[model samples]
Target: MLNAFRARFWDLALGSAMTVLFALSGTAVALPLAVAQLLPLFWRRRFPAAALLIVGSATAAHTVLGMARAIGFFPATIALYTAATHGSPRVKWVLCPAVGVAMAAASAVRHGPVEGLLMAIVTVTVAWLAGMERSEHLRQRMERAAAEDRERLARRVHDSLARTVTVMLLQTEALRATTPLDSAAEQRIDTVLGAGRSALAEVREALAAAGSGPALGPRLEMLRGAGLRISGHPPARLPAPLQDITDRLITEAATNALRHDGPGTLLTITTVPGDGTLTVRLTTEPGGSASGSQRAGGGFGLVSLTADIHGYGGELTFGSRHPAGWQLEATFPALVPGHD
Candidate 1:
């Protein structure tokens, strides 16, 4: 209660301070009107044009005032527009002041006709800059994220693919070295060859999908389609957070289910979203013995999951089920619009 009050108080205090500062130092306009241009930044992305209009309307008001006052803020507007668009650190200040003066003179000459044109120009410039910045930022971020994903995939290939291929090659060598009429060895070779070829195909697909994003839906679907009817729990959908943290966990979980339990094991990821948090539960039956460097060492995917969740200001936990089975669980705070 105290912390919440403190937070609210700080919010009020900051807002009030900003309001006072803008009123005193700004064009002596009210808070809502003067700072109105920035309202678009807080709007939902789906309503982009509306957001642009809001910012532009505010810009129009500001530009008109600055023109009448002969105060040079047109360059600042251009800079704001540019910063918001190209998101570049430095905006060309060259013509902004000149533009402002000209706009003011034009406004006077036309008795407010040019005011609309100047406002439109400023609005368009800011909108274009914001959009360009967003696009470039998203593209760069996706590229980095894709690169990380591919790196993780390359590791998986190095681990599982190399091991599977080696087994295949060794099995082939053993089969060749077997004497004539080696029925048992011949049958083993058939199994090994089949497994190897399947593994090779899977590896190739993984490599292809590395830099690319995952196919939609559950990871187990990939395993089940590959002829592993391994089951320990039930059907599971990934948490939204895990959607951003796939590859390693997906591979590890599937590997454990397939290798540890062989086949016919049920695995389920249970999700419970409530009370400003999202909970994830992964349950595996008797076959839930966790493998991999971290899990095998009794180190925590739960801990990591918790850290990840808490990074978003949430929590996570893991434990044995009531009656039986091993369970992994995570809880994350759901993002609330305009709450930030």
Candidate 2:
């Protein structure tokens, strides 16, 4: 019950001060008059500035009021100063000194000099603090916005580089088996293949080094849910985020296999985790040579794979057996290997 009254009184006091500050922006009145006029604002409002202004105004006005009571002029001013702070701008900084002097002059015929100076000093200090706090709030909001942009950029890099390179490695391997006897063409293919592998390696390193932070766990769960045909023993000890990255890569490789081959075709996937890296082996059976129809129906999965693996500094390679299946192989730095 007492809390409620305290709240109500603060509101009234604050509101009264703000109303007077806003209303009394013109020519200077005596500080004592301003305080007496604005003091009621505290009872009706909760703002700190309004409360501060009221107290400062009251202090300045007290001198004017005391003198009038001693002399034979107007009634003595009753200045009530309260303590509080608020979110809004302070009006008392401008009002207190100006009003204090004017009101003092009016009361000079009655009240004396000493008290007016003290009131002027207190009003200005409270107003300064309110302004500084407001600026800090604005600065914090801007920093939050900048951090969001960096996260978006990181997601984009994941989609483009790692995913693409993996699919391309698959396509190159398919071509390796069917190509005719042309020595120059094979050399050119080797050069292109070497460059592609190098690009894949660089991208994977970046991804591995970045270390996923908060995003690692969710990404792993998503890949595990995807339709990946797993045959080997499930890993018993893998860092959650790194395990997730590998799972996602496997899921994406499975997607490419389905995109290229009919559902009935067999796909074998193997993962070899070593001292500081992991090797992925995927073999998909083709009913025939990867033909014009297959090439025309290009898969952009490679682009996605490239982006994902690039950040981890991984490498991917492809080859095909004459008997009809294609192979996709990739190596990743074992589980964000750098940080450990």
Candidate 3:
């Protein structure tokens, strides 16, 4: 109620002020007509088309009566702008021409036909241009809002679902190690762990789709307590698009080590500067000697890592170790690798 009163007050205050100025300037002689044309402006946004129709009809009537003052143009100009900003584009197109014709008819009745038509055309063009500018500003504001929303959702995913998945993987490992189970039970636990790891990967991809932000490496530090050994240089700043990708790759690799390599797996992660390349290697090995079947548990993470590396003209490779485990290596082109 207060807001409605404030809006109505502002419209009346400004409308009355314009009317008085025009009256003094000999542009408007009547107060009632000018007020009628402008009073509806208070509701312009709430009902743009209806407000415009009311103002436009009043304007047409005032012009026919030869009491049309230059000040009277203010209300119509504002009404058209409100409609353009709030109404659909089709409405903008229709109102512009209609307002122009009304102005021309009024001008023809009061002044000579040629002079009135010219003045109407100029006034209508100015209103149209002002409306277009308002619409563009509104569009830009909406886009910024949508982008902010996506970033908010991304942060929530990281804080909630992603962390939960990590906890599940860690607990699964602890359960596997402490309780001796038959082969069938062990296999079931492995399946659940694998699914949890895959969910983490999907969350990482969601972060990418949400848009870039501050380096995620800092955030990934929470996983240190989740049962995976993380050893590397403190995450470094990389090239524009590469920073987020590198952070995600590191997080995903560490997660795969903990989840898929089974209980008591050792992970060795190394990252450092090389000649024109940023080198990253993650090697995972089971605690005990691996048989032929155990050696192939590298998981599906390497496929995405390979594709992302290739996008930046980098090379990615993975191979089974001689004794046990799997080693995945990727080198990204960097003009200055070690430099922050």
lDDT (10s digit) by residue, model 3, range 79-189: 877676656544677865687678667767776667666776677678867877866665555446546856888999999999999999999999999999999999999
The C-alpha TM-scores of every prediction are 0.43, 0.30, 0.54
Best by TM-score: 3
TM-score of 1: 0.43
lDDT of 1 by residue, 1-340 (tens): 3544554565456445544555555553444655654434433122333443454455445555552222223323433433333221212132223333444444444345455456544644564456456545544554565578567868878787678797777768675677564788778777777888787777777777666456534666777775444433432343333455433343445555555554554566555644223455666554334231223322454355455555544455555555544455555433311222
lDDT (0 to 1) per candidate: 0.48, 0.47, 0.67
Best-to-worst order by lDDT is: 3, 1, 2
Ranking by TM-score: 3, 1, 2
RMSD of each: 11.8, 23.6, 20.9
Candidate 1 lDDT score at position 68: 28
The lowest-lDDT stretch of 10 consecutive residues in candidate 2 is: 71-80
**Candidate 2: segments with Cα more than 4 A from true spot:** 1-237, 286-298, 335-340
Which candidate number maximizes lDDT? 3
Q: Tens digits of per-residue lDDT for model 2 on 106-167?
A: 44433334443333234333334443443344334433433454456556776887778878
Backbone clash numbers for all candidates listed:
11, 63, 0
